[model samples]
Target chain A: MSKVRFGVIVFPGSNCDRDCYYVLKDLLQVKVDYIWHQEEKPKGFDCLILPGGFSYGDYLRCGAIARFSPVMEFVQDFAEQGGLVLGICNGFQILLECGLLPGAMLRNQGLKFVCQFIYVRVDNNQIPFTGAAQPGQVLQLPVKHNEGNYYVEEETLKEMKRRGQIVLRYSTKEGVVTREANPNGALDNIAGICNERKNVFGLMPHPENSSEPILGSQDGLLIFKSMLQYMEDGEFRYGGGEEFRYEEGREDDLDA
Target chain B: MKRVLVYVTPKKGILDPAGQATQRALQSLGYHEVEEVKIGKYIQLTIQDNNFSESSIKEMCSRLLANPVIEDYHYEVSDV
Candidate 1:
């Protein structure tokens, strides 16, 4: 293909479709198209994005209803075949609902909808999503959600840690991961994660919302740029061995 | 016709913020004996009697109505 094509599947209530489309099309200047939720399976696209918003009015759960959309069946097949897929905010919720990524989101521990720019430390920059970022670099990203509190059973969490599927965590500007820095109290401050194959990634942060300086931060654009780079030049899938900074409170930490 | 009632709730040991908030609200309202309040979803589905199967209902609950990762679900079927 001359240019890498991207498809942003728009669920019925997805409000951030334009934001993602704008970044991939206008800012990144790539071949991008929109796939309505009811549309047929997508083909010929290098990557697919599930943008942020209250799909199906977030009925039953943040992503429960949206997961069953016709396009998602194709998305599941796409991710299984190692095609790159990224989900943002509510999109991330849908990914979880569909078992694209392991874990579930609970209401913010504080019981409020939090909307703010928070710093996130890139835990594993080897993944395509963070290839352009420096190792352990703290990126200022915006997260707006009520149910961004990520939760996974303990045993699976250990396996995720061992495999480095965790790719980002809420953190201080100095790249320090701390409990106080966590906005929604996501378990171990997880903000972003990828699957074991590293082909599917999901994060509660809204990268599109912060993709430009005019939006108050251009830090989020790095994610899009890196993904584009991967489409063109990436030949290997990365599995990481970096130490997670938020390991302080895990079961193993107490033993140590 | 048939009716299915699915009840979904956060699994034990998982934090339930909305439920906790409700508990606090009740306490503030002088319902101190209401030691705990946990919120969950109740979904009622109307189905064709012949199309309703126990396995299918369970599948729907496990796949869509409840996320087994952090929530639990149970459903009852009744004639309508």
Candidate 2:
């Protein structure tokens, strides 16, 4: 298999860009490059990553201002074209603001910045991002954010569950999905999800931070390794076949 | 100039930790009669164009000033 080329987008305030680049380039021995936020083109990359950080100083909202960055337009197009895109932490917020992913993030339920290693159970291993793990595999990843609570309409949540779009959920070390184990009070204890096509993935955890044993856990490496396996096997499914239709509801009538 | 004051708030039913915290603080401060509290963003923009229509202002609110997924926004436009 050919080397998988990964592009890590670097927003002005993105602090985890180097971490992702290092994991892909040095640790995983893959081809990776940094894409600046001002760049309007994301050409010739097999995978694109939006690292975690307080982009645009978290102005207006966590990712509201950064959503309009020049690079995000390209990222959207890339995702629509069936390119693999992973958004982590602040990156997840940007993906939500850009409409690439469903739902929105709210301030932590406790109204505080949460920074610690939390467990997330793999809800679906069929998707490219989690293909390396078992269906109920548990991973310990570091989640650090002030606004990480995920919310969606009840109907949308139902649809997401039906379609297996809910990729990861906050869970106990024993893989129990319980409200008591929820770190940020996310809806259904969701920690990560993918778009309908499963090509775009967004999660509030910092997988890059825990990708090595020296970081106290190598669980995060599974996600990246899964992507590599998917690429090597040439079984990447392009989501462009079906028309992307979000379930219509009262929420869609907001602009009407 | 036309000044537009945009108010952006989390949609009803959405959990707002900041607003909840504020409400708790108010309750602790002896405001027992307060039913609820909601926190939101107030953005004031001065546009130089006099031809800006209400529809366009509403469009702006929906497109950039607010996230329709979790927020609702309304604006008042008036001559400065």
Candidate 3:
């Protein structure tokens, strides 16, 4: 089979460029390249990963300025053409700011920058990234962010659900990962989401951290594996896992 | 002329560890009467037309200014 080419974007303040670089090269055994955020566009690659880090010092707000980067124009164009893309943590925030994703991430409700390995359930395994995994599988992954809260309105949330855009959720206290397990306390306990087309995926958790047992657990490898499978199969398999439960009193919305 | 007041708040499901920590700080400062505190942003904008509608501004809130799901926004428009 031909090798898959992957690219990682490096913004001015991105700290995880190398980590993401090493993982895609060593673990996935794919051709990986680092494109600076200031570049005019993403080079030819089948997949793109936006690693997590504080971009532009998280100034103004998380990912506010990075969205306007020159590189993102190309990245957006790539995604619009059905290429696969993944954004982790701040990258996820940038994707939202760029309107590549549906929702927004706010400051941690606790108002603290949290850094730890949290367990998340793979809720939607039908996408190209998570398609091979079974629903309700819990994967312990590292999430480091001060602003990782996801917000969307009820109607839009419903649309995302109908479209199978939600891909992961927090693991419940009982060790089951489901949409209801919202570990970060996100809306629908969503840990990750994809665009309507499912080729663009964004999540706060760092699967690259858990790709190997020495690093943590191999739980996150499935995400990449699933993507590879999609490249081969051209289709995804779906199973309805836990029912989505939107927390009551989650009526809080933002306008500025 | 018209003006609109916009309020931004964190959605309920997301963790607000910072707000909770500040509330704890306020309690230890001898202000024991405070029950809860939520941090948010507020902005006021003036428009040239009185016909400026809430839906138009709400579009701005959803598209660029705010994330409506985790954050709730409330606005009051006044005609000058």
Q: Which candidate is the best by lDDT?
A: 1
User: DockQ for model 3?
Assistant: 0.34
lDDT of 3 by residue, B1-80 (tens): 99888887766755466677888999999888998877877878899894687789998777656655456778888887
Off by over 4 Å in 1: A236-256
Q: Which run of 10 residues does model 2 chain A get worst, by summed lDDT?
A: A237-246
Individual DockQ of the candidates? 0.87, 0.73, 0.34
- Native A-B interface contacts kept, per candidate: 1.00, 0.76, 0.65
> What digit string (tens of lDDT, one per residue) describes model 2 on residues A67-182?
99999899999999998899999999999999999999988898779999999988778788988787678999999999999999999988997787988888889887788778
Ranking the candidates on TM-score from highest down gives: 2, 1, 3
Runs with alpha carbons beyond 4 Å of true place in candidate 3: A172-183, A234-256, B1-38, B41-80
Instruction: Estimate, for each residue in A102-169, the C-alpha lDDT of model 1 and write its tens digit.
Output: 99999999988999999998888888888877778889999999999999999998888877788989
lDDT of residue A181 for candidate 1: 85
Q: Number of backbone collisions per candidate, in order? A: 0, 0, 21
lDDT of 1 at A214: 89
What is candidate 2's local distance difference test score?
A: 0.88
lDDT order of candidates, top first? 1, 2, 3
lDDT of 3 by residue, A162-234 (tens): 7778777776545554543444557767789999888999999988878888986777888877777776565
Per-residue lDDT for B10-74 in model 1, tens only? 89999998898899999999999997787898999999977878898899888778889988998
